[model samples]
Target: MRLSLNPLAFGTAFALALCTSAALIGSGPAAACEGRTTLAQSYVGANKDVKAEYVYCANDLRSDVSTSTGAGSDIFARQNDVCGAACTTYCWTPSGGGPDPNDCTVIQDALLYDSENTGPLFSLDPATNTSMIVMTYNTCQTYILDQTNSSLTYCRSDWATLVNYIAFNCQATQNAHGGVCVADDQRWYIQVQHS
Candidate 1:
């Protein structure tokens, strides 16, 4: 498996933290049944060894629902919108510099925890304050955003790792104004199953 996370490795500290704060999420989706709008639901999360008929519920048929996958904040949220039964699940080392938030997914567990991220690997420059590197089958080699002007060059990993797992390619030329990167036309998408 490309990703292996043994909860034991997180040690007692992380566990204690999770135990102390996961009260809200522990209740899960069942608790929201009071006013839920689910319509003939099958299931939410995916299994490690299963790839059944990936369902697709339309916008008019569903609501913009979400669920938490980790501790209190800044972790990850599963978006269950236009996911066509949409959900993006991810589990890995809590690294600061990784793929774009929107690009990271775990819908097909095999693509994430089962493999070493088989797609365009884009990560913020870990060594610098401003920069992101892109790698894939596509031509865009990098996102050299260390200077005032940097563009997000795209990549297409042949193993079906498309941007948002859908786009063939993309670009977000942005400038670090006041030491913060700014791309007027770029944004991140986060969709996860509330299972």
Candidate 2:
């Protein structure tokens, strides 16, 4: 006769499987907003002229205070008591769908205008199931004090550059990937299927 297996083993195995699945699913876009095309509503303005990620302030510094959690004040206090009168807050807000019919050519034209100074436009066919991701490097620093040593050190601001990089490439890549559509790093992809 076969020995009865322990119930605890089965429960543990099942829990492990569930956790693994959840981790994988969570890694991608959130379900609430997944598959819903999102447009870049930047502080600068929406790029309705071109089918591109809207330029939000374009590296401009913030004119007023942002967070009140004292993060800004703390950062300012440590930095030689100088947060400066004009500090920048680089960010994007979710708007609506990707580019419309006229967006494709418009964006291309805009890129052409800046072609002299920008990188080559990366494109891929939607049928290929690949995306062109843009990337860049930036550095910003705010001093912080250590509780144990009571010394200050520079914190990283690399994320600012990464945000800009995503905004730069996401639209073009999505346009190419979505059968000539628009998309962003937030995975807001909208496909305008060809007739």
Candidate 3:
């Protein structure tokens, strides 16, 4: 089951998930957007503790939000993609299609960019069953709270550097997993930036 998400849902659900129980934890990107072709780079050893799971705002194909209420399943929030000033996370797969509409456990912030203006930074090749996912961490917080988060700052202001950082970490992760992370019939490739 896949789900598209938004920050508003996470912000609103934060209290609910917290008050619910401790069992809520653990969960689980890519494709569509053909402006760039980025493959997984070598992962960094010093940054192994780094998390490479939040990559929203990269749009090639678009979808609405769904709920996947699971333990620790929020994809985290950020804004930059479709929600405009609002926030949303989009979880979609070419095969299974869009996510279940009621799932809110997975969170990824939406963005507001004219598909006509921005070209594409990533793309999904269904033939190879591969997708290059570009991620921005803490992006929504930076947008909403104006907090000092390095990842968000880097992503909002300087994207090239952020993309480089993401590529390096992605390589490192792929190295650990034999140069690939596979699920279903797809092989996932990633690029990301964070604090």
Candidate 4:
């Protein structure tokens, strides 16, 4: 007597095996969500030592977001929009512009906190002439108040990071201008009238 295996059964088993292998090998869709848009802008005050760079991620479905400056040996401060979630922001300014003596790297990490509303995270108060960099992970959009121009500037991320981390830098500067200057990662600069 001769026995033959059912074609349907063999096909189903083969498909299941292939899917299991793909998942185990990490070839499946990503578990974390990615940002729909990213934005990075650098602002320098015309008068007084007020310089800052704002980076933002909007509609980010990822778990968290973080970032840092690229160059320069100056003190840096950062804030994010992870309102209720576990978030951490830190900066290590080497005594000068070079690698750390101890071979250490600056780190900004934002972990799982609340997944709902990310943030208006930072604030811009024209009355006080103060501005803050803000970021939001879950929300579809983010904004920063252009106090000098008396207008609202939108911010978002263009790509995604491991933890949905997005960041930029802000340094104080002294110049002279009546309007607001905006700079982005693409190196585009524009002046807005302070209305």
Cα lDDT listed for each candidate: 0.22, 0.24, 0.23, 0.22
The C-alpha local distance difference test score for the whole of candidate 1 amounts to 0.22
Quick one: best TM-score, which candidate? Answer: 3
* Pairwise TM-score winner, candidates 2 and 3: 3
What local lDDT does model 2 show for residue 173?
31
TM-score of each: 0.18, 0.19, 0.20, 0.19
Q: Where in model 4 is the C-alpha error above 4 Å?
A: 1-108, 111-122, 132-147, 151-195
**Model 3 C-alpha lDDT per residue in residues 114-153, reported as the tens digit of each score:** 1113332323332332333233233211111111111111
- Badly placed stretches (over 4 Å) of model 2 are 1-48, 54-103, 121-190, 193-195
Ranking by TM-score: 3, 4, 2, 1
Which whole-number lDDT from 0 to 100 does residue 144 have in model 3?
18
| Residue 1 alpha-carbon offset, candidate 4, angstroms | 44
Off by over 4 Å in 1: 1-21, 25-48, 58-117, 120-195
Question: What are the per-residue Cα lDDT tens digits for candidate 1 across 44-155?
Answer: 1224332312121222211122122231123212111111111122222222222332322333233333234434333222123223221221121111121111212222
Candidate 4 residue lDDT tens string, 1-195:
899998534533442332221111111111111242224444222221222334332322221111234411122112222122211212122212222111110111121111112422233332333333432322111123332212223222111111122122101111111111222221111211111
TM-score, model 1 to reference: 0.18
Model 4 — TM-score against the truth?
Answer: 0.19
